[model samples]
Target: MKLHLASAVSRLFSKILRLHYSFFSGKILSVRAICTDAENRIYLVRHSYTPGWHLPGGGVDNGVSVEEALAAELREEGNLQILGKPMLKYVYLNVEGSRREHIVLFTAQVSQPDGFSRNFEIIEGRFFSMAELPPDLDPACQRRIQEWVIGEFGAAAW
Candidate 1:
């Protein structure tokens, strides 16, 4: 079922707030991948419940392996199936929302990308040429693309 953005956000924050009130000392791990088509375009998604376009991925739930989490997220968010084993790219410390959050990044070739239709969780999904990323791309998401995809690891403006 398609959830309204406010409703989805409420559900998410409600769950997290529950944990926040409890005695918790756990790190949040999320998986995001640089999934490229055969033509070398990267698949990015804009969520119905969130702003900005980003690489297709999500949080790894308990009892699920990191790779499995990535696969499932890619499938759900982009109608993508990894063509082969995903290669570990990098792990980023995402300090925007919480100190305990970490993002695991991977790279993979994918298929069936054309099947991605707008769904409840996702507003849109498509492959983007590196030279033509959207203006509203998340800063951190754009940074990862510049560093990892564009091979600009150390280019920081001082």
Candidate 2:
């Protein structure tokens, strides 16, 4: 009976530890722009912090609405105006176990070519066709992009 009690206690401790690890490891909420041009190219940014090309967005600020976060990230990273409403929202759990909730993705059209000088957090930015996406993009970003593209344009077409 004592041995069984000890095993149960051990299991409870393990479960608590797992929950603590999942909660306090830090979480980030990010917004991404699926900005498509008339040519159907999507704007992606090369991040200085992460070694991959990602959508023009970043961590959402505390107390800010998702739409505000998306707009702010777009202005800060891409230096271009987002002209429309958000088309999709994705929740992505990265490999590091950090959760990004409500990764608001906006689809907009840009007429002027804004200079991408890598300010605030972005290192480089450029537009690429779906087929020409960079190989080193973040896994979550890639998945969101693929899902967005498929939803906007039919899977058979894109």
Candidate 3:
């Protein structure tokens, strides 16, 4: 089991390195939000291109603020409206993916719009209770939830 886990980790790093070389260069900034409703249900989205469910977010444009990027991503990906000031949770240095890549994560209480339909970029967005999270949830998102919501902060590479 340990061997399998190590092999999987190795392959993941290999892929990350390949991606970095092919697509990414210089410093990269991105934003992700942990959007929860009054019922404490977490909202997550599955992208058409990506394989797993994750926090709704995208890259921060060259001149855009992180807050603006977060808001835009929440609205576009999950139909989420921020109810209050989003609290900064953590800034993770995604060194494995790209040495200069950083992910700015925030926690926000959000409200979903009346009707949310799938679009080209996002295939699905749903609020899932803690006990009912999707099996294919992104590992990075899981780590954020554990650290921010469950207060299980650990030494982890995000």
Count of steric clashes across candidates, in order: 0, 0, 0
- For residue 52, model 1's alpha carbon misses the true position, in angstroms, by 1.2
Q: Model-by-model lDDT, in order? A: 0.79, 0.65, 0.82
Per-residue lDDT over 1-158 for candidate 3, one digit per residue giving the tens place of the 0 to 100 score: 75445556656765776586547567788899888998999999976555799988888988899999999998899788999799887788885665677888889999986746777667689999999999999988888888876765443456
Local lDDT at 45 for model 2: 84
Better of 1 and 2 by TM-score: 1
User: Tens-digit lDDT track for model 1 on 36-138?
Assistant: 8898898899876567898888888999999999999988988899998998877777765656777888889998636887766777899889888899998
Q: Model 1: runs farther than 4 Å from truth?
A: 1-25, 150-158
Per-residue lDDT, model 1, residue 21, is: 35
Candidate scoring better on lDDT of 1 and 2: 1
Tell me, by lDDT, which candidate is best: 3
TM-score on alpha carbons, each prediction: 0.81, 0.67, 0.80
Task: Report the lDDT of model 3 for residue 119.
Answer: 70
**Residue pairs of candidate 3 with colliding backbone atoms:** none
Q: In candidate 2, what residue range of length 10 has the lowest lDDT sum?
A: 149-158
